[model samples]
Target chain A: MPKETVSLRQAACTFVMFLFGSSVIMGVNSEAGQDSWISLLLAMLMALPIILIYARIMRLYPEMDLFEIVEKVIGKIGGKIVTILMIWYALHLCALVIRDFSEFIKVTVLTETPQLNIMLILILVVVYMSKSGIETMGKWSVIILPVITLVVIFTMILGLERIDPTNLLPIMGHSLGTIAGGAYKIFAFPFAETVVFLCLAGSLRKKDSPYKLFTVATLIATVIFLLVIMRNLLLLGPAVTNAKYYPSYTAVRIINVGDFLVRIEGSTALNFILAGVIKTTVCLVAASKGITRLFGLCNYKHIVFPLGLLAVALGTLLYENIKEAFDFLEIYQIYAIPFQIIIPVFIWILAEIKVRQDKAANGSHSPDSAQTDAAG
Target chain B: MNKKGKCFIIVLLMLFLLCGCQGYRGLDEMVIVTGIAIDKTPENDNYRLTFEIVDLTVPVKEMGLKGQVIESEGKTLFDAVRNAKKRITKKLYFGQAQIIIVSQEIARNEDVGIIIDWFLRDVECRETMCFIISQEETAREMFEIEALTHPLVSTEINNILELDQEVTSTTLCVELYKAFGGLHSEGEELALPVIHKAINNGKTVGETNGMAVFKDNKLVGFLPPNESKYYLFAIDEVKGGILTLSAFGEEHNISLEIFENKTGASFDYKDGKVKVTVKTDTTVYLGEVMRPYAPMDEKEINELEDIAKSELKKNISNSIKKVQSEFGADIYGFGNMIYKKDIKLWKQLAENWEEHFRTLEVEVESEIEIANTASLK
Candidate 1:
């Protein structure tokens, strides 16, 4: 079969959507109070180095996903153990995002609707997206990303009358330690969460540079997050923003432009759902890919449906209620470290050493043969 | 089955799941609530809720839109709301609710936080709905008055509160979100407009005027309409209002329409006491001159401007002092200003802010400009 490749632009769009996934609705950690924009900026700076490392791994193994790379670099036993860990992370992350979306809907709009229904419907759509292949998912992201950006910008413009810049006063009110903690939470969440993209990188066209894709997506997502943070802070003030479970929805609730454009928070709901669908789809695809590699299956698509069902079931049984789900986020940053930072770093370092060794071995025989050997 | 046929069957099944039949409620099945009035029962501590649901039975073109009131009693506000269904046939939808009126008794005796908690927590209730304290004996009485201009007294009160801010500046429109913020914030307190019944053209109507000041979440005192204007000026909430000035040794009164105004408060903390300097820049047009106007020279205009400035300064200082001694509530948000200006200083002062606010010294400086003579000169 011919290889399936995603264009560089499509991959960047998908990565941006993944970053915006749950953060758009859940909002960033507001522990920094009105200085949350500062925390977000700090988070982007901290995420930059890690994002570069992820891209470097993709560059080293140009045609292989992280699962294939891990098996190739580590021995068979070590690779299987690592793959099981990664598969668990991907499935848990998928369930978590699914739960966040369903909880938001249940709390805000569809109070009477059962969460199981919401999760099942969402998982079905995600499973279909995953079954159609990464190329379809990438194209869908390319089309849906602009709509999400426009909706966010539109709400920001309409809410301009309500913006009180003084709410952001005493800019450095938080101690550096508190702001750094908030930045760490933000980095683990939506920024470093892009580590999932390593599993999808195999589909990226060989001619396109992973470095450019990762950097561009991160910069764009950072700018959008900064605007969202400033918008919520300026409109709601830090006290109310921190008091609410969903600050973005609460902030957008007050956007009344001459009373004509009242209750435009529905648009915010749309933005979250669209971006969330892309994120869950990415996670589902990654988990299925890991499962296929672990079991030595011929195709990942064959088990996509069952994995999607398992994710929905896990989402439903993840927590007793919405409050517990939110409480989980406080420790989510620490929980994500091993997967987002530790394992990725280990793989990148091993890939680099292996590439150097391969180059040394092939240089003695023929310079042109190094590329073919690495591909093999 | 072929692959295409199986794919089609799955897509059809998914589409069936996408329909929101389970949670869907038709418009006719729900009664839209335009206003809510909460009162405390005279005999018990239970809440008495009066919801003014929109009367959709009458045709709009002939009778105009109207509201029908339904009363329910329960232990909590949400309970009272659900109990309202006993009298009505459908669920109360608050998505279109424009005003919430609470009785003075509830505002004075009960914790306003407990009363507003239900609205804040409910999904259907919009945070933008205006909140008001009724000056009448019972908040429901405010709804009993006939709606002369509009079919619904709640909508009429909403319109008055919204429009009066621009024309009178005697009341501040506090939305649910702003009230929630004020209740939770350490440095600032909540203040809402006061609504009452008045006879207009031999017909009773609901009118919104004056302001109710709160110390924390409990009502402390009230500011009359005239004093409320200066309160608006002190807080920089004045968009437009008439500032009447007496000229020629108090013989003739000249009403100056405020064109634009800006107020800024700066704090100076020293010797365990804080001093606030409030500076206001105002531009006005000579709206109505009691005496016939002769085209005045620049010196005359400057003199008049100084008179307007000193008059405004005296009124604003007096209003701030009245609130300080009478209510001790920082409705002007001076404490909030300090909190925003310097967090460390605020941390020191936030614990006993009320006592500090009562003893704090305030100085008012104002600059007024007569921008236009209103075509009289």
Candidate 2:
């Protein structure tokens, strides 16, 4: 069969990308104090030019995915080496996303539910998106995105009653270096993780969609991040947020509507599910597609069933304990920098130089291809 | 459609269908717990567990305050709740629970630490619920009172607690999570709101009298209503209040009504006796007066401000002295103030901070001003 194509709404695609990007890099609560949002915004703003670079590369070779581009950029063997590393990075990320989502659900809502069952349930939903192609993931993203936004917005409204506003005092309170360190953590986990989209960018009917969608989605993500961070700060204050692991959950529990509505701590659990699923789906798609390309398969479906099974097994057996799981995320943070940022930076620049030299050699179309208007 | 694709759609439909209907409670098996009361018995080894549960099917208007409060005797609190589960038809649902009252006798006992521990370890019990100590009556007796508004006394009790939290500091709505945080600080003593039964013409009602003071796990003493306001003010939570101040030889009391309050205490390390400076920034909106006082003049305002400051200082000082000297408990949190201010020195002094606090030099400063929406020119 022709590669199963997915028709996803631009908004949903943006939300999927935004949530996927943020989840992997940032912590629900970290040592950065109140400036966690600052790191998120900086990472997002920093991703703009890089998103443009993705568009530039995609426009140069409209029909080819990332593996083809890398192969073309540095010949077959050289391309295979980088592509193999990229493939590992993608698969590892997909596994981590599944692990985190399953672990979170198991702890939060599905306390009595088996871990295997939870992982299986999550993978079951995600398989629909991955196997059906981008269209299913995108449509679900659109359907889920609006509800998620409204839930968050509703939560923000409820939380406003308890927020003291003084908790945000002593702005930029910590040293910039500390904030930068935190920003780097966020950059690795959430922001930089968007590199997976590079795999999907070429397949977009609108190639420039990633650039436009990335910016808009990043802006939306930044606003939500600011609201979440601000809500936690206002409700818990600096002292409490620094003390608790799930500050967002505690923040919602305090929201008593004139003494009637009580203990809706489950709101954060809903959020983790909504944002976490989209993120896992993106990872699954990226990993499955990369493998199909790497192995020279005609269709990506053959790997989907096996990979989904692998995800279930990997998620179930991955971390022996919660501490090990956290250690894995932290280690991945440092390790992900190379794949998410440095390599992308390297490929982007090389692609730019090649475009320049190709312009010198082949003339106009090479240079013109990178122009902002011509990019999509 | 392919074989695998058809299988996937059917599976999705089944999963949604299964999760759509989840079981909460069966009609005959569910017993809804409305109120929980833990009180100490006269014997050292025994305690009383009181559960006020609602019959699920009854409508609030018809059942108004008619639920039975089953009392079970036990050595430990968790056992009491566990025993009650055996007595009721409906499951003990705590999701609608408003308050947990520990008798003054229970609060003062060292064994109360176990109760706080139980609160933190359980997933069913939330930290956001209000805690109270029945000052002069049994917690069960207080729960027995017929509610004025919602015949469901529990609903009324929860609402009154919420309303008072906004208006007065005397209604201390302390949560378990915050109590955990406060107790974690080695220097500070713990205090919870005091609930008591008010008998007027033999019609008893649930009344919050003051605050139940504690040193770690054990209750120390109770603050009277007036003194508890100062505690609330010190915590910067008193929303509004009225205070009367009289000169040493003045004939009558000059009352100042407070519109806003800002309170802070700082630790000063000067001598062997640690010094603490308590500050209160208050805005007073004066009510109708007694002799020798004008309601809205600058000269009167200045005089009122001075009197307000002196009165507030005296109230706080009295509470501090009573807390330090009578209770001999470090309930004022002087230890935590020192810790956050000087962690290194605090580590050295942490062990003896309680004794060091007795001689700690404390200065009370109150700044009172008249700030109204309209100018009194």
Candidate 3:
């Protein structure tokens, strides 16, 4: 089979949508209360260097996914251990997204529907999409991205009447330590979680630098996070915003424009569907890639179905109830730190050492000698 | 199609079968509950819940609309609501319910937090449901009153509240989540509109009596229309209302129509004590004048403004006093204001806030601007 590639535009769209995956529903760092936007600002700045590390790692090893790059940088035995961990993280992250979305639907729209059914249907779609490879997933994201954007923009515009700007006052309401802690949580879940993209960076068509995609996507997502957090805060006020589990849903539910446009909260449901599907699909694709490489399989598509089923099963067994799922979110920030940040940075350092050592060994490094070094 | 297409189609079919069409409710199979009224049972501790269900069988062109009121009793609110399924043929859907009326007994005896817990947790229930305390002797009797305009009592009450947004607004429409917010808030209190059946020209009609104040989760006191208006003013929520003032030595009455109202609160911390200053800016247009009305000079207009300002201050303070001294409930959200402005000061004052609030000094300032007199001028 020929190498499949996605356009840079599609990659950027997929990245932005993935950032919005669960942030749109759970809200961004609401623990900071009225100071959530401050936490978000700090989260974006903190996430920049890590996301840049991901791009740099990809640029260093073109056409090689994290699995391949790790094997080259680290020995085979060490790389296999890291590959297993990456695969497990990918599978676990995919199930968590599935559970997040299915729990939302269970509580909000479909009360009596079995949670397993929701997870199954979602995983089915994700399996089919992942099987189609990265190009199809990227193109699908590009197509649905605008629709989701318009839905969000229109909901924000319609909600303009109910926003009480006083809700945002008394900024920096929490202690600096608390606000920074909230920033760490935000950085881990949505921002640092982009480490899964390292497995995807190698799939983009060879062209411009991947930095443009990461930086531009992060900026767009940060703006969206700010808009959503501020809108929920202003519309619901701090008291209600903290009381309700899903503040954004409740805020949109209160939008009564001449009684005609009531219940526009279903737009939020649409947003969760688009982003959640894309996020889960990317995770599944990455996990399948790791599994295929681990087993020396010929094609990654063969494992997408089984791994997708495994994700659905894990989602059902993840938590007993919605409260437990939320408790997991509170702990997930710390739980994901090592996988999302520590391992990637470690590999990047090793790769950097290897690149410099190669240049040193060459002794007359230039563009021509670099080509020879690559062939060697 | 190839094997992959066939397998994809099979999986789609299985998916639909798995979902079981859970949310598919046909119009005919579902009953739309527009309003609910709850009252304490005469003998037991159970609650008698009445539901105002819309009858969809009626045609659109017919002037006469049909609705049914069903009553049931259970130990809990959810039990009572679900018990309706025994008598009714279709499922009772509350997504359209706009009003929830609780009897004075329930408001005083039952915990509203527990009563509304079911509504808040139900997926079909909306967060915009209005909480109303029935002033009628029997709450079910209030739901039985035929609406003069709309087909259902709830729709009529909803309309009345909407229209009340304009002239002399007496009651505040408190949504379910806002009520929940107040109930869950640290030092904030909750207030809901009171409704009752009134006999007008021998016809039973529903109207807003005043407002009910809640301390924590239980009903504590009631405020009349005048005081409720002032409470809304203090909270800076008055949209449009008429303010009547006396001028020309009480001989002539001038009514000002409120157009814009802004309320701001500032905290003054001095010597381990807190003082909340409430400043209100009101923009009004002259609406009515008694007989023997004449163009007034700048001095008289200033005098009228002063009278309006003093009147606003007195009524607002009186409302606060009644809620503070009598009920010891901080329904004006002064504590919330303090918390927003200065958290450290609020934390120091958080304990025994009710006592502090009762004795705390509150300065009410009103700036009234009269835009112009209407066409009568």
> Can you rank all candidates by lDDT, best first?
1, 3, 2
Look at candidate 2 and tell me the lDDT of residue B258.
73
True contacts kept of each: 0.67, 0.03, 0.67
Q: Identify the leading candidate in terms of DockQ.
A: 1
Candidate 1 overall lDDT versus native: 0.88
* CA-based DockQ, model 2: 0.11
Q: How would you class the docking of model 1? A: medium
lDDT of each: 0.88, 0.68, 0.85
Residues A227-316 of candidate 1: C-alpha lDDT, one tens digit per residue = 788888889888788878888898899998997888889888988999999999999999999999998888899999999999999998
Highest TM-score: give the candidate number. 1
Model 2 CAPRI rating = incorrect
In terms of lDDT, the poorest run of 10 residues in model 3 chain B is B14-23
**First chain TM-score for all predictions:** 0.96, 0.88, 0.96
Candidate 1, residues B1-377, lDDT tens digits: the string is 99999999988997786766576888889999999999989888899999998898888789878789899999989999999989888898999999999999999998898888889888799888899999989999988899877878888888889888788889988898888888876688888999888899897888776999998689988999999999999889998989988776765488889989999989999999999999999999988867665776778778788889999999999999999999999988998899889889999999999999999999999999899888866
Please list the Cα RMSD from the true structure of every candidate, rounded to 1 decimal place: 2.4, 5.8, 3.1
The TM-score-based order of candidates, best leading, equals 1, 3, 2
User: Pairs clashing in candidate 1?
Assistant: none
Candidate 2 per-residue lDDT, tens place, A328-375, comes to 756877788678767777777777676667767865665454553354
